[model samples]
Target: MVIQKKVGFISVLFIISMHSWCQQQINLVDKFQNQKIKAVNRSITLYGDQRDAIELNAENSSGIGIIEDLEFEKGIIEIELLGENNPGKSFIGIAFNIQNNDTYEAVYFRPFNFVAEEQIRKEHMVQYIYHPEFTWRKLRSERTGIFEKGIRIPPDPEDWFKVSIHIKENNIEVYVNDLSEPSLIVDRLSSTKSKKIGVWSGYGSSGRFKNLIIK
Candidate 1:
């Protein structure tokens, strides 16, 4: 009888330990920004190669060499981006809604300089593209529902910026590092749920992304 009790106690302890470890792993996925990620590959091309970074050319096209496979039933996507290049008319940000191995949609931010004014403006923007269809549409000003226009979250050009995007059932929230509130929020989207995720760039921009986490 005593031997059975001892065995039962050991089993209980092992179960508790396993539960604790599982909880820790779940928390790690839930809060992805807090972990270190090694780069898997560079540029999602037919030939897979690992490079240090990616560059964007003209005609609004550039992509990270590395691709992460993630599914977001409902949660947040977070990343750290390091920006570079000059004469800055470029779009850089995270992407989702990838379909058919050839097309996807993205929400990107661009740095712009006004002709009349001397000030530089960072454009917080969103775009949807159905590739092969090659249809690209902007999701600012034209679309309604809680979108703040002309808001700038300045990029350091040399430092990493923590960008967090929260996607709930009916809302989207975007934020930069150390900011208590989101820089942009939209309460309504044509589709509130998505699974695919990626990094993107466009038109004369170069950048690096690291520490990507999706929950």
Candidate 2:
């Protein structure tokens, strides 16, 4: 009886240790593989307890981070974003072909309240635009257009949302929350090739991301 009890305890301990190690491995892979672009100062630390955490500032343009620089011609990219303090005005989403520190094409998801004045009058919805020339003025309509239309993954303010994007030739498809069909698709937009991927956060809002897989 004593021998059996000891063996059972050892087995349980081994399983727990294995599970913890696997989780650490996944986190490490996401950290080392992606190119981090912070709009604010950031830090990654591991304590003696063998646990790790990444910290970032929520203000300024310090909340942006990029995973991969991809080609705009053809391919698919997906990301899982965990939002913190998403109040109604917070914004978190992906940007492509970031030419400079200030410009790129972004597909963003924010609450209806955060919609810009021009966007508010036009349509109360999420946005996807080609921000050419690095200014909001250069925003050109793409797949979804000015009207707000797409799946709304309920904002938990403390939870995460899975966003997936598919770009093939001149067609673009966006999906939120593992829906069967894409929520937004833009047919063609001048046929320009691009290849860059990153994440961004606004002045007061903050977001964290993981499980970024590309194919």
Candidate 3:
């Protein structure tokens, strides 16, 4: 699917197989029982890890493909993802309750800068972005030490990790790998009635997805 938006300066393109890819997507959609998936740019790869799984790579312009049938006003969203070990790039996470291509609250890990030797780079392991209005660039320039932070127990950025987002009415708690504690917590989130689930990656970043269970 091709999503055209006037905002957000980004996009994605599918590589690999088209026929086989369609078959795979069909199986996944059937398995999930939803057709609202915006797997544009042909970047979503699916598999079964004793269950269902998928991978998304941000190709051209900061790729973000939405899952249309899935919507969440308030709940916990869990995603298991693997990040490509690409250098000099940033991002890997979920954009939930998305209003469209230009609007959504995104929280992703800066794998490329996750465990840098430099103290400043290390502090950017975790980041939060509300697109269009609050891109990562603006967040860093305007609100330093507010939207992003380093992980207390840092994991290998390139390796697979599970991120759980606990969303309440106005609050959010982000837990990575560990469910007992949150790596970052926000007292407030941007307001929206969006129910879309997007597999998001920064421009040129690659991410894999699987076992998405909302509770």
lDDT of 3 by residue, 1-215 (tens): 24455222242233224433432222333433454467644366654455455656567666676876555677777777777545656567888778867678888887776568899887787788887788878988998877788787777776778888888888788888874778787655487577776778877776767666676
lDDT of 2: 0.53
lDDT of each: 0.50, 0.53, 0.70
* Distance from true location, Cα of 115 in model 1, Å: 15
Candidate number of the best lDDT: 3
Which 10-residue window of candidate 2 scores lowest in summed lDDT?
A: 44-53
Candidate 1, position 31, lDDT: 27
Task: Highest TM-score: give the candidate number.
Answer: 3
Off by over 4 Å in 1: 1-68, 101-103, 111-153, 192-194
What tens-digit string does per-residue lDDT give for candidate 2 at 3-120? 9999999999999987665431124234533534333233322222333323233665434454432334355667776555434545666666655555566666664333234644
Order of the predicted models by TM-score, top scorer first: 3, 2, 1
lDDT of 3: 0.70
